[model samples]
Target: MSKDLEIGKKIKTIRKEKRLSQSKVVEKLIQKDINMSRETLSKIENNNRSISAIELKAISEVLNMEIGDFFDEEEPEDLVTFFRKRNFSKESLKEISKFQDMVRILLNHEKIYKGE
Candidate 1:
């Protein structure tokens, strides 16, 4: 399959996994100053249309995902779902975010050390 088609499929998969409707995503996009229609989003998701970088970034934000996750073979765990499942308090969530940042930094350092 083409890269665009692959990306479109990933977007659709992530959106569905997040339990989000195309309309919901489009609404979020509009709040981000992106004027995409649900129909257009559907087209993009179905691989009938291509997505621009700006649209991809906006959609990623709406889906609460890092853009790089879309290109990965393994699906990322939905952090929102994780928090909801645990019923974490706001303070806990903030601490978790800080811990995640530290972990990310360590992973980056490891990659650099390994010359990856």
Candidate 2:
């Protein structure tokens, strides 16, 4: 995949994983007094335009991820599905417990049952 598409897909993936819509992001920016048009957000997500460094930083912060991690790519498999398959053992339980978020907890248990 092209770099832009990869980034775009990652952006969309993370957004959906977090149950956030573009309007929600826009609303968040509004709350923070940082505004961007929905068209601009769409373009950035569609790889139609290159996102600026400042925008990328802002997006990373808004999405609650380190900027560097955004660049990681996977094969054709869906990441949420892939992560769901990985089994968590007793050793991994302690680490998984640190995940306070609902979806993260569900995915962690899923991995544990899947015997990954």
Candidate 3:
């Protein structure tokens, strides 16, 4: 799939996961002075229209997600599903917990390195 479509799919998935309707998202965008119509948002979510940087930023804010989340090659939902579908042993669970901690530490270090 195209990158634009991928990003749009991510946006739609996250919006739905957050229990937000397109109209509700548009309402929030208006509160942010974006003036987006629900139709426009639908088009965006369907990959029928391109999104501007400002629109993307406002949408991310309304969705309570970072803009970078939309651009990630791996979907977070996939990882969640993988974990949910697995019946791990105690040792495996412990290893997963340690891996999660390491990932957190690495992310924190990356943020600090970037002066974020």
Candidate 4:
């Protein structure tokens, strides 16, 4: 598949995996001023339209994914790179890293159970 289509598919898959509806996802983006409609989301998921970087970034935040996650599906995100995306205080980073590590462990366990 084309890169655009691949990215779109990844977006759709992640959204579904999170059990999120298109309208719900769009609503989240709206809070970030993305101003996307459900139809736009459909077009994006179907690869009939393209997404801007800002839109993708906001989408990532709403989806609780790293921005790089969109461009590199199937790759594990580094905790440091993940933290750098947001401007948290140093003390916050330490706490966040611990939380993130716990989440990663759970995610990895799920992936293993799913035989991925």
lDDT of 1: 0.89
Clashes of each: 0, 2, 0, 0
Which structure is stronger by TM-score: 3 or 4?
A: 3
**Cα lDDT over the full model 4:** 0.89
Q: Write the per-residue lDDT of candidate 3 for residues 1-116, one digit (tens) a residue.
A: 78788888899999999999999999999999999999999999999998999999999999999999888666454333456468766676667777777888999999999999
lDDT of candidate 4 at residue 109, scale 0 to 100: 100
RMSD (Cα, Å) for all candidates, in order, is 15.5, 12.9, 10.4, 13.9
- Which residue pairs clash within candidate 4? none
Q: Indicate the TM-score of model 2.
A: 0.55
List ranges where model 2 is wrong by over 4 Å. Answer: 73-116
* Candidate with the larger lDDT of 1 and 4: 1
The segments of candidate 4 whose C-alpha lies over 4 angstroms from its true place after superposition are 73-116
Positional deviation of 33 in candidate 4, in angstroms?
A: 1.0
- For 2-43, candidate 4 gives per-residue lDDT tens digits of 777877999999999999999999999999889999999999
- Worst window of 10 by summed lDDT in candidate 4: 72-81
* Window of ten residues with lowest summed lDDT in model 3: 75-84
- TM-score of each model, in listed order: 0.61, 0.55, 0.62, 0.60
Lowest summed lDDT window (length 10), candidate 1 = 72-81
After superposition on all CA atoms, how large is the RMSD of candidate 3?
10.4
